[model samples]
Target chain A: MTYCCALRLKDGLVFVSDTRTNAGVDHISVFRKLYTFGVEGERFITIQTSGNLATTQAVIGHLNNHLELGQEPNLYSVNTMFEMAELVGQTLRKVIADVTQDTHNHEQNNYYCSLLLGGQIKGSEMELYNIYPQGNFICATEDTPYFQIGESKYGKPILDRALIYEMPLDEAVRCCLISFDSTLRSNVSVGMPLDTIVYEKNSLHIPNGKRIYEEDPYFRQLSKQWSDTLRRGLQKLPIPTDDYLD
Target chain B: MTYCCALRLKDGLVFVSDTRTNAGVDHISVFRKLYTFGVEGERFITIQTSGNLATTQAVIGHLNNHLELGQEPNLYSVNTMFEMAELVGQTLRKVIADVTQDTHNHEQNNYYCSLLLGGQIKGSEMELYNIYPQGNFICATEDTPYFQIGESKYGKPILDRALIYEMPLDEAVRCCLISFDSTLRSNVSVGMPLDTIVYEKNSLHIPNGKRIYEEDPYFRQLSKQWSDTLRRGLQKLPIPTDDYLD
Candidate 1:
């Protein structure tokens, strides 16, 4: 399983994803699930993928191939974030169809994938989208400014409570890390070396992104502090009053 | 869907369950999912259920009918908690089999149910078991002192971090409430009017249990305070340092 989330705040977009993937318990491996496509001062795009590693890799491969070949209507050529998401969704569906055609068991095979696509295009507002396996997609709205894929429930409560559209970029980053930390503690399949990218809205350039490992001091401190703070917070809540007995 | 959890502490057992059942988003109703049986000073047992409402209701109905009939090898007549759990599992399997036998589409029907059973007999140690749809069950160990069924992931992190085998009964109750509150916030299918019970070890009697409604004062305070405490706690954590760019 994977746990990847993206927040489309007023200031920018935040993307975080864990790198662990497994075919089964014994066949676990580390695979980067975050990919970036950008043209400095032109446009920027980031995608975090989950489910069917082969399908995700194939979709990413096709995108990269399109760029190398200077293909029209590619990620680099798309005029809008919505169009980019559509292209990615179409590519994902095509890859899944091609891979499963020989199996004669498309329904049973369950070879599907999902993605979070977020970025900016010149002269347009930044946007974020959740692309489904069937080549359909939905963009984030003001009321719902975040999208999470894979192993999402464990980390969702914090995001639901703490995330805000107008929060500072740094605070949003903190919330995302805390959310990721919650998921890591509860699930074993989502492991370390997280890839995180913070895109400042309208900057149209990819800022410095971090690959956090187990030994990263800041992440270590953040995880420890969050845990301690939660325990302390729980302790502070008033115990059930005796009236509960009645 | 339902969210029910049981914890086996040194003092006794704690059970909590939400009372919402839905065939679909449009078809939802309130139904009690927690049941208790006791022979004062002899034995006490509690079962919290989730999954197909009919199957769980049938299983509970059968158990109640057996007691009413004064049947031998019933809950009141069982010699051990293990035997009691085995009987409940068998009864559950029978109920599911009976309900689904008439349907031709059993594979796709998914009329499965799960249960969390906990309590003690006069001479036995307190025990907790998670009974599966297959009529098999597993007891909680010191390493895993709690069990949750249905919509469990949202509430699991708190239990994972705060639950201890030796906590006081009230503290265990507090922990369970926190867990339930987390689930309630993140999931719409698990609603208010929660049923909770606390048993004291070797007492063989049910203590005062709570049916917490949406307007229950203590619960309302707890919910508000918990959310405030969590938000405050998140604020207290140090923000990510700029060194992350390296």
Candidate 2:
């Protein structure tokens, strides 16, 4: 299981992904679920994936191996974020079809994987897209400026309360980290060693995002402080009436 | 949809349930998901249901309508908390079987629902159980003293942090309420008014259980104060470093 989230805030876009992958309890391994495309002063995009590690890796590998545009559309050649999303969906479908072709000789299984794409082109606004397992996608709009995939439930409450289209990029990144921290504490399937990337809204370049491990001072402080804050908040609330039970 | 949770604390037990039900987006109504039974002085048991409303209601109706001693074997006469949990599970399976019998011709669909049972019987300690759709149940242990059903994710973080086997009954109740408030804020499908029941250990009877509506002053205050507290907590956190964007 994985948890990846990206928020397109006023200042930039914040992307974070956990690196835990598991075939089963005993078969868990660390696999980077994030991939970046392009370099400085050009089109930059970061992709995060969850579900069916085999399928996700295959789709990403196929795209990476054939990124050039010779009338053959691919991630690097896509002109806009919309086109990039379509390319991702098309590639996902192609890869799944290739892998499932021999299923009858084996056992039939549904291919499952989803992706989060967020980046900025030179002239366009930073945007975020949630690509579904079925090779389709939806973009985040002003009404909802973030997309989350994987073990999303344990971390959803804070985002629903604090995330907004107008939030500063720095604050939004903090919010995403706190959200991920909540999920990591609650679910064993999502572990530490997070990969985070930030793309300034109009920079059209990739900034070197931090790789947070168990010892990252800022993350450690945030996790401890957040839990402490919640405990304090809960303790301060007045006790309810004992009338009904008395 | 609904959200129901039961916590077993050293001092007692806490149970909370939301009342909103819907067949589709256009058909939403309020229906209590909690049912209580007791012998006044000997025992008290509270059950909260989630999943298909019809299935849950049918199961409850089966318990309420049948009065014969051996024939019913309902929650009312159960000797132990485990037996009470098993009775709820058996009732659920029976209800599903009865409903699915006509599915072939009527296309009414499968029955799906779960139950959270918690309370005490004479001369016994307070306990909690999560009864599944398949007529099997699991008891909450000292390490895991809480169970949640229906639209559960949004409200799980607080419980993960604040719940402990030795938490005070009052504090447990407050934690459950805050959890419910978080769920209600995030998911429209789970709404109030709510039904909350707290059982004091060894008493074998529930005295602090009641229905809470939107206008309930205590609930209103708790929700408002929780929101204010959360906002303040977020504000107190340190601002992200400028490196956060990189």
Candidate 3:
């Protein structure tokens, strides 16, 4: 029901997420799934969520609650990005456990949700992680360099084909949006506008990134031109040797 | 698992399928999923299957049994493509139902399978139908001229971007192969050595179609060139307006 991706490139980290949330067909709504946390220049972190809306919101709420209440072991209290990931994963797992406690099916994951956690600490390396519904997490490595959660397959081929570890930050942004474009066109559950955030490594600050609305000229042109380019490119490919069959 | 796609284009029909079949990672094997049946010069029908291999093979077996026994309403006796579609659907449904009858869970569909049936009968229009496991089928119209079954999403965006009912048959075949290439790259469940069959509307007879092995020269060229083109094409797309942020 969502298309969210984050990449850890040479220059920085890029996070992108769709805002469409749906509960069955009739209960569709727009909700921002991108959240940023940490002390301004000391650290920068963003979490893009997908799956059960209630659970994701509840997880965010609990994390915020920790911050607001000045809990001893909160987002602000974490030092390295690894601890931040552990805290977020623990909180996510706890929230799902609390919400689905009344359900008889322990295996029922109606309340399960996942998150893409990415950002950097003051002196730490830029990092990206895919946090699982079960509170486990995996870090992005040079070979992986990125993570995508929810409605990922339709948009994945392009990323697999084009994205690289050393990609320029600007090109990576376009690549993610193009991935998003593929998803938005094929799946109704993932809609515009997309929320994106970019964090420069060691700058220890995160910008609001960009919100690409459906009507944004650049996005519109990008989507249309990409489709046109694909059509043209497909035509350019040589036909089979057995054209006589035609 | 498998990746099979069928396109109903203005020129004719194109069916493409991967040969990977795996009960588990350790038990992987190669098996053809493309099949043809008809009374040549009168009717030519091709079926591309996906899902439970046993169910699909059993369905094929039953159809062959009917023909061998000279049973009424056999594939050879079908007068129209619609009838052919119906016969395939019924056989598929019967094969699944019979196999799963001993299991108590009616909701359990471990034996489920799906098929894409396409071809023409003398004096009738060329038609393409997607037959579901429940013995129901839907025909492809101008607006929806293609059907993909099994591990479909990874390869779908390219088709959505370029395939059209009026597309040239040669181009359609190439497009289908590219789609297969995408799926094969992203999924271990779908594998190499593609089987492709092209049918010209009134040709009435069918050739054993092309087999594209992993080492095949043209296929290797297309796959390599496609990745190169995509990488180049991706670089050409305009970066976001916030390039200064980089």
Per DockQ, the best of the predicted structures is 1
- Of the two candidates 1 and 3, the one with more favorable TM-score, higher being better, is 3
Task: For every candidate, give the share of true A-B contacts it also has.
Answer: 0.56, 0.60, 0.52
Candidate 1 on B59-148: residue-level lDDT in tens? 998999998998877998888889998999999988878877877774624788999999998877999999999899999998999999
Candidate 3 A-chain TM-score: 0.96
Error of 3 at B79 (Å): 1.2
Kindly list the per-residue Cα lDDT of model 3 for residues B132-236, writing each as its tens digit.
999899999999999999999999999998999999888888888889988888889999888888998778887678888889988888888898878888789
User: How high is the DockQ of candidate 3?
Assistant: 0.59
Sorting all predicted structures by TM-score, with the top scorer first, yields: 3, 1, 2
The residue pairs found clashing in candidate 3 are: none
Pairing residues by index, what is the TM-score of model 2?
0.91
Tens-digit per-residue lDDT, A1-246, candidate 3:
999999999989888999999888898899999998867788888999999999999989999998999986888888888998899999999988887788878455888999999988887788788999989999999899999999999999989889999999888888888899988988999999888887777888668677778899998888888888788888888778863253
User: What DockQ does each listed candidate score?
Assistant: 0.61, 0.57, 0.59
**Inter-residue clash pairs, candidate 2:** A244-B207, A244-B208, A245-B207, A245-B208
User: Which regions in candidate 2 have their CA more than 4 angstroms from the true location?
Assistant: A68-72, A101-109, A241-246, B66-76, B98-109, B239-243
lDDT of 2 by residue, A125-146 (tens): 7778999866899988889888
Tens digits of lDDT, candidate 2, B73-109: 7666667888877777888888888878767744543
Provide the lowest-lDDT 10-residue window in model 1 chain B: B237-246
Quote each prediction's TM-score.
0.96, 0.91, 0.97
